[model samples]
Target: MKKLEIACFTIASIKIALENGANRIELCNQMEVGGTTPSHEMVTEAAKYDLLKYAMIRPRGGNFVYSTEEFESMKKSLLDLKEQAIDGFVFGLLTEDFQVDISKNKELIQLAHPLPCTFHRAFDQVIEVKQALEDCITCGFQNILTSGLKQTAIEGKEILQALIQQANNRITIMPGGGIRSSNIEELDRFVQANWYHSAAITDGSNTANAEEIQNLKQKLHA
Candidate 1:
């Protein structure tokens, strides 16, 4: 089935996306920094709903690589929200040289068991994306959020297409960064992916406007 994961930075945006037909959510905070862990209140409230929800587990957004302490914090956050209704958590980790941190990622995925896991846009920063994809698969990622290693999904659509073809249903290739109503229809025609991700933002406010979300759905349907 086709799906959309709205990256909502605020509770208001989450509601707007849900009301406007978003089926899944990537709950986060500090959109300016690529997003970070949401507040406990936000996670608690979001879990009360029956939607497919994933809380962003990023502690700080400078880079995907984490220090020992930072990794410990991510562990704590995941454990704290263990009993929530969240279907999964979105997270990523890489080494200094941009290789997949297979050991840590495997551990984290194991820790997030039962709740499926997603490797977020940190995928875009990897050096060997194809190998990394296989690594995530081995680590048991339910899906991966990426732009095919480009700055935006549109610019990366060619590589995204290749990645999708290579995946061949092993995992979902969710087009994310820089997605908008204006470009999504064209992107759909190009990528033909089953899943798409966006925040439905139409402005710098970083809020998911209901009208924008509706327009996005209509565009996909068209």
Candidate 2:
């Protein structure tokens, strides 16, 4: 069956996501700036809940490229959160020229060992989607959250479909950016990805709308 994963910016959103039928959640903060790493306190609190959660490992939100200090900070954050109840890690590292930094990504995936890893939307910024997908697989990422290198999953559905075919079950191609219940069926009809992602923030707030989350889940099953 298809699964719905919600991008939750706050603790309140996580509760709503669980109660409303979400299969999993991408836990992070500052959705307005894409997503940054959540605080230790937030992760600690979120761990108390019974749900599959992947903590975002981004040090900051502007871009996927990181400075030496920022990269170290990401490592520290991953180690710290690994101790929490986080089920997996979500992160991406890119070269200055927009290629996947295979070595760096592999280091984190190894650190996250045993737990899965999802290379986040930074995949969209890659100059070559096909090659980047291969690099991510080499780095041992279990999933790649992308909009098919486009701004939204709907607009990128064609590419998303091609990606799914190319991946051939080597890794999961989870269409994420701008996914919603209204367009999910259409995207599924085209891309047929196993996983879909959304913030479910219909009211333009940081919190997720429970009804939207339910609708998304119900529609995915329907």
- Write one digit per residue (lDDT tens) for candidate 2, span 1-222: 999899989889988988998899999988888999997777877787898999999988788889999989999999989988999999999999999999999999999999999999999999988999999999999999999888999988888999999999999999998888899988998999999999999887899999999889888888
The digit string of per-residue lDDT tens for model 1 on 1-222 reads 566789999888877877889989999999999999889888877866667788889999799989999999999999887777777899999999998898999888899998889899999999887899898898899898998799999999998998899888999889999888899999999999888999888877988989888888888888
Instruction: Itemize residue pairs with steric clashes in candidate 1.
Output: none
Q: Which portions of model 2 miss their true places by more than 4 Å?
A: none
Q: Give the TM-score (vs. native) of candidate 1.
A: 0.97
Predicted model with the maximum lDDT: 2
lDDT of 2: 0.92
Model 2: weakest 10-residue lDDT segment is 39-48
Q: After TM-score superposition, what is the CA distance of residue 65 in candidate 2 from its true location, in Å? A: 1.2
Candidate 2 contains a number of clashing pairs equal to 0
**What's the lDDT for candidate 1?**
0.88
